[model samples]
Target: MIPNVLTIAGTDPTGGAGIQADLKAFSANGAYGMSVVTAVVAQNTRGVGSIVAMEPEFVAEQIAAVFEDVRVDAVKIGMVANADIADAIRQSLDTYAQCPVVLDPVMVAKSGDHLMQQDDVEAIRERLVPRATLITPNLPEASVLLDRDVEMSSLEEMHASLEELRALGSQWVLLKGGHLGGEESIDILTGHETVELTAPRVDTINDHGTGCTLSAAIAALLPRHGYIDAVRQAKKYLTAALRHADELDVGAGHGPVHHFHALWNNAPLQLQGAQR
Candidate 1:
């Protein structure tokens, strides 16, 4: 059976990040995608301009509505704009705690714009981190979560942070080392065992939604794959997406990775009025 994976996140009209990217990654990973919007964000490949967060009550209602009818096999959470919404998600998700949850602690955008407030960080750590089956945090996010002034830059540093991150209550923590300067990107997964997932870094400017895509891919794969296997497969998918990212001509600034790179083999789009 196809896994029913749900994404609880903000909107990215550009289809590169947030809920749009989550849905695309879910489909590419062979899962049925569902979504509950938390914020309406005005963003593109360039950057986020503005955001309007949904009421906490409405956010809970949306989650309740999906759970009351559908079988949510897994969930990927991203960009909860504030503390209240995070609280609402934490509470709303309690009833269905059995489903696997992948939490991407999205604090900043690719453009270096802050997507969440400083205080909101605490709320996520307190409410969501403990509830997550796996928490995927890039280097900078890990620093913020640990309240470190500088980001962890070396493999030793990443390994050191793993125990501290796991102490926050997550069953597993995948610390992404993409920010490290190297030809290979290494992500350390710690929980049942320590595993290093290494992929040749795809050098490209179009990595706008890489974090969102990775976590969503993991969530979509978790129902069928084991913990370490899911992380490995998700890393493989994201690497291919990044490698093919340049094939797309989306926008001026940092663009998005190709979520459907494996399936969409450069077929020309059919124009409405063009001759065949």
Candidate 2:
């Protein structure tokens, strides 16, 4: 059966990130996607201008509604915005702890706008991180979680930072090295073991929704396959998505990666089934 994945995140009106990006990534990666919006942001490739957070109870209701009807195999979480929403998500997931949860610790947007509050980081670290199956954090987000400056100058420093993050509670930690200046981007997956996956950095400035897309892709692939295989496949999918990032121009600034690139190219057929 096809896996069903749910995303608990904010709404990106531009459809480049948050729940919109998660759904697109999930669909592209062959999983049925569902969403529970925790907040809504007025945003685009330019930047985020305003945000409207959903009440904690309302967020809980949305999650309950989805879980009541769908058999979610995995979940990807993004931009909770505040502590109340984070707490609500933590509580809701506690009851469904068996599901594989991928936490994309999104603190700031690619356009340099804060997506999560600084005060709420501790709540996320304390309440949510321990429960996640995997936590995907870029260098800056990892720094915030680990309370140290992540040195991008060397791979050893990066590996050490990832190990420190792994001690925080996640069963697995995929520390993204995209922020490190280089021709190639290396993402290290460290948990039971460390695996280094690298992709030549696409020369495009459009990487707005890459994090959301990556985590969503991983969530979609994990249940239908297995964790290690899913990570390998998801990396390839993300690299292809990034390569096609320049095809479409959605906004004036950093735009989204093309999540449907494979489908557009008529890729090899897999199990053509629907998740219910």
Candidate RMSDs in order: 1.4, 5.0
- Candidate 1 colliding pairs: none
Candidate 2 residues 10-65, lDDT tens each?
Answer: 88888889999999999998899999998889999999998999999999888889
Worst 10-residue lDDT window for candidate 2 reads: 267-276
Best by lDDT: 1
TM-score of 2: 0.93
Q: Model 1 TM-score?
A: 0.97
**Regions of candidate 1 where Cα sits further than 4 Å from its true position:** 266-276
Candidate 1 whole-model C-alpha lDDT, 0 to 1: 0.94
Candidate 1 lDDT tens digits, 166-229? 9999999999999997999999999999999999989899999999999999999999999999
Error of 2 at 175 (Å): 0.3
- Candidate 2 off by > 4 Å: 149-151, 267-276
lDDT of 2: 0.87
> Cα miss at 217, model 2 (Å)?
0.2
